[model samples]
Target: MTHPIDSTEFASLLCSRLCHDLLSPVGALNNGLELMADETDPDMRQRCLDLLADSARTSANKLKFFRLAFGSAGGFGDAVPTHEARVAIEGMFAQTGRVKVGWMVGDDMLNKLAVKVLLNLSLIAGDALVRGGQLDVGAEKRPGVTEIVVRAEGPKLVLDPELRAALAGALPPEGLASRTAAAWMVRSLVTGRGGEIVLSAPGEPMLLFGASIPG
Candidate 1:
């Protein structure tokens, strides 16, 4: 059985996810302001403006989706709406860093921990496709348990060692912090539900993994 998480751990991981998502936009805004302030070239300024727009769009879209994924859309002591969950996934993928997002999960109202598992698994998959590729999100529910799977298929699949460690539950603080904090949240939520996660190798260049939560 998995142990429960304390408020401190929960708060720390949640804060990390928010900060990580905001950094790109906030950084872009700062850079755009600076560029506009001095050394303004028509072409260069346009590029800066474009960068700002891209960053803002990415940040906004991600936040909108995260509100459902990370928020109480599901498992807030009440059943979550299937359409809302679908909308959450759709909202999250409005823009891709370099890769595309694919949806394959059947619509369902996931419990809170199950939602976190999917969210964390997606976070890991998103990072793996840094060079641009496709991501697949799917889930399955059986009596007494639910399984959420996230797969990243591209020409290449990269798995950070620290991520492997964190998934194994022996994470080092420094290395753990460097990873998307959502990873930890996923871990916490899954384990709290007496569940486990499995990450497979990129055979033929595909990263696939899933988390199972007790029903």
Candidate 2:
């Protein structure tokens, strides 16, 4: 069984995860700026400018996604519009040209916790698509339960075993790392609220994630 983590440690893990995700684009932005400053050729300068723009956009997209997924988005509102979650997911993967998303969730709203679970699961699914692929997300609310599913298909899909353990609430708190933090967070949120999470194994051609929570 996974042991409970103190708030400070959990927050640190999340910070590490965010930093790791943003490092690449932010580093590229710095490199682009440096190149633009040194290059005298007009074409090379223009290329640097373009790279900077892409990096800026990527950085912005990641912040937006993380704000909703890991921050206090939706504020005091009890329910967040479904479109907002959809847009957040789309923006998160926008820079990853290798991945495509099929959003099957409807226009109805979702509670804050539900949205959190959805986005975190989507993040894991998208990351599993190592060679770029399609990710489909769907959620439905019926009476006492809410159902969420994320499916990923690509040329080379991998679901890390440690991540699987984290998602299953089998990974000890001490074993948590930046790579598996999101999965751990998702599992904590779902099961904390009397919900259950599931994932497809690594060897499968596609990665599938499912969660059921009390409505």
Candidate 3:
């Protein structure tokens, strides 16, 4: 049976997920600052500066992606520029330097709901590429529906069972956790809008996620 998650609990899970992701880069920024304050060697100081810059960029990129994926971004408009979503996805994977993103979205703009679904699924699929890989994101609008697809191909891909269950909306409510929050959110968003999410078979060489939402 499918379990339902209340809004309050779901919000808390999302917040936990955001904090967990930000912790590493934000901690690096702090460490870099501390090192800069104590380091007297010119070269060491330059290295610290570089680390600080990289960390700051990573933090900013994560925030931008999270803002769109989990927060109230893109203003009050019902539609958001597809370019923003593409940029957000690119920024999200750029920090790892392991994954390459191919954006095949032809639509100039998509409804805000579609953008959210697109980014969230892309995030999940990209993360599954544990050993780094190619992530291709595509989206298109039909007469009465929006379709989004994310494909991940890598040397080593690992999609956790809990996440898979969450995406399929089969996880029990008590089984939900921060790690599976994004997957749950994707399922919720698509299904709530009278849509469906599809996952590639477990033994597939590559991971594919597709969502179709009716307007």
Candidate 4:
């Protein structure tokens, strides 16, 4: 068993995760605005406009994805459409263009908690593809169980040992960092509900995640 995280501390950690992901694009937006204000050349001004637009889109995409993955999305529903999740995931990777997403979820709907687990795991798997590779996410519902798999194949893949430890509940709660918060959340949510999460060995060319949850 892992040490339980304090509610206040966990919330702070999650906030850190959100800010870290948003910082780059959000900062870009600010910088673009500053450039636009001083630029006199028409062509350079247009370039600034392009930068602003791209930053805005990136910010929006991240927010939308986080809304569903971490916040209250599909309000009041016990299940959320799998399609929505796919769109959210696609939009997030769309910004980079290097990472390609292959969604293979056969189920039309997933329970709220299952969807959260899928998205969080997908985020971690997607991040492992540092060189930007293929991400395949799939989930299936059986009579009494639901299984989810996230696989990443790339020229170079790295799953940090700290993240693996957090996902396995081998890291003490005090050791959890903002970078590994999502993995910790996945482990906590799945194991708290009596589910199990499997991870491929670190440094492998391909990274795979398997999660099983009882219905």
Candidate 5:
């Protein structure tokens, strides 16, 4: 069963999740600036500059990904170019240097809602690869429906029960939190369109998520 969440509360949870994800890199950027200001050695100063550069890159990548996943990224259009989403996903995992993304989306464009669901599910699957892994993202449009599939495989994969529950639309509204906001959003988006989500078994060697929504 799908539990209804208030719009205002859901927005708050998303905001909190965004802030939490960006905090570490943003804080590193600030610290790097402070260190550069006080450092006298050229090598140390150079190191600080390098830190700043990496932090800036990470922050930018995350913002780009989140813009598409959680915000209005493709402007006011009803459809967004699939390449943009491909780039966003690549940039997102590039920062970690631990996960490789394989994009198999054949469509040139996807509806805005489909883009959001794809990105969010990809985000969840990528995060499940605790010890770094391969993430495969694919989507297809057929007849009157859009289908999305995300797969994660690694030596160590961990998908939290709460997130799984949220994705399955079995988590209660009162139990919602920032960590599960994206999963819940994916659920809401799919179900709102009279769609359904599928998940691999808990003990499976790989983590998989699939969604089919009527367009």
Candidate 6:
């Protein structure tokens, strides 16, 4: 069987990916600038150095994870490792921010489309609970097909309007930049799969039929 939206354009996708990685460094620079202004003593500068180093490392690790998640971890033709996807999610949270990512879903090798789809959805769920909430992720495969299902769980979900809008592709997510990027990433991956998005809300527990995987 042929897939409808089975491929991603690397050049355009690369832009999406670069958008995600640049944030950490830009944010770190802002923090570093603040540090530079606040302290005059050498010891204080050293402290700043440590902070900078930590932030840089955090950014680097996050970049690696995002590259695997949003960028091209493997070639377009290759199946992405499900374990790698899970690890990338964990790594994103553990290194980039403070979210504690918990996996409820078992692992299996997923195609590139599935990896990117799950990755973006996980980010959306994590964003919904920005105040450090637990992330529950799960997955299932279509009956004897290459299709797959993925999900994210959390309490007190914070669904950004722009993110949602971008998910629908109703408007470009220029305002809620990061959230927008996430929205675009997920929507693009899911849409690129020629699938539909089934979204629940902040008040809802389960986001059903979020997307239909292609065969």
Specify the highest-TM-score model's number: 5
Listed per model in order, the count of residue pairs whose N, CA or C atoms clash below 3 Å is 0, 0, 0, 0, 0, 1
Residue-wise C-alpha lDDT for candidate 1, range 1-215, written one tens digit per residue: 22345667656777776877778788888888788788567998888888888877767777766776677654447556555655555556525556676776675666666665776677777777767688888887789988788888777678786676567665645444635456666776778768888888435468888888888
lDDT score at residue 79, model 3, on the 0-100 scale: 90
Q: What is the C-alpha lDDT of each candidate?
A: 0.69, 0.89, 0.91, 0.90, 0.94, 0.64
| Candidate 4: 10-residue stretch with minimal lDDT | 1-10
Tens-digit lDDT track for model 2 on 1-215?
Answer: 35688888888989999999999999999999989888999999999999999899889889988998999888898888888889889888745678899989974899989999999999988888888899999999889989999999989988888999999888998898888888898998898888899887668878899999996
User: What does candidate 3's lDDT look like per residue over 73-96, in tens digits?
Assistant: 889989989888888999999557
Instruction: After superposing candidate 4 on the true structure, give the runs of residues whose Cα lies further than 4 Å from its correct spot.
Output: none
TM-score of each: 0.77, 0.95, 0.97, 0.97, 0.98, 0.69
Segments in model 6 whose C-alpha atoms lie over 4 Å from true places:
1-21, 24-46, 95-97, 144-156, 169-182, 205-209
Report RMSD for candidate 1: 3.5
Candidate 3 residue 207 Cα shift, in angstroms, is 0.3
Candidate scoring better on lDDT of 2 and 4: 4
Question: Sort by TM-score, best first: what order?
Answer: 5, 3, 4, 2, 1, 6
What does candidate 5's lDDT look like per residue over 84-152, in tens digits?
999999999845789999999999999999999999999999999989999999999999999999999
- Candidate 6 backbone collisions, by pair: 128-158
Better of 3 and 4 by lDDT: 3
Which should have the higher lDDT, number 1 or number 5?
5
Q: Tell me the alpha-carbon RMSD of every candidate.
A: 3.5, 1.3, 1.0, 1.0, 0.8, 5.3
What is the alpha-carbon lDDT for the whole of candidate 5? 0.94
Question: Whose TM-score is higher: candidate 2's or candidate 6's?
Answer: 2
Which stretches of candidate 3 lie above 4 Å from their native place?
Answer: none
- As a TM-score, model 3 comes out at 0.97
Top candidate on lDDT is 5
**By how many angstroms RMSD does model 3 differ from the true structure?**
1.0
Give the Å error, residue 19, model 1: 1.7
Q: What lDDT does candidate 2 reach at residue 6?
A: 89
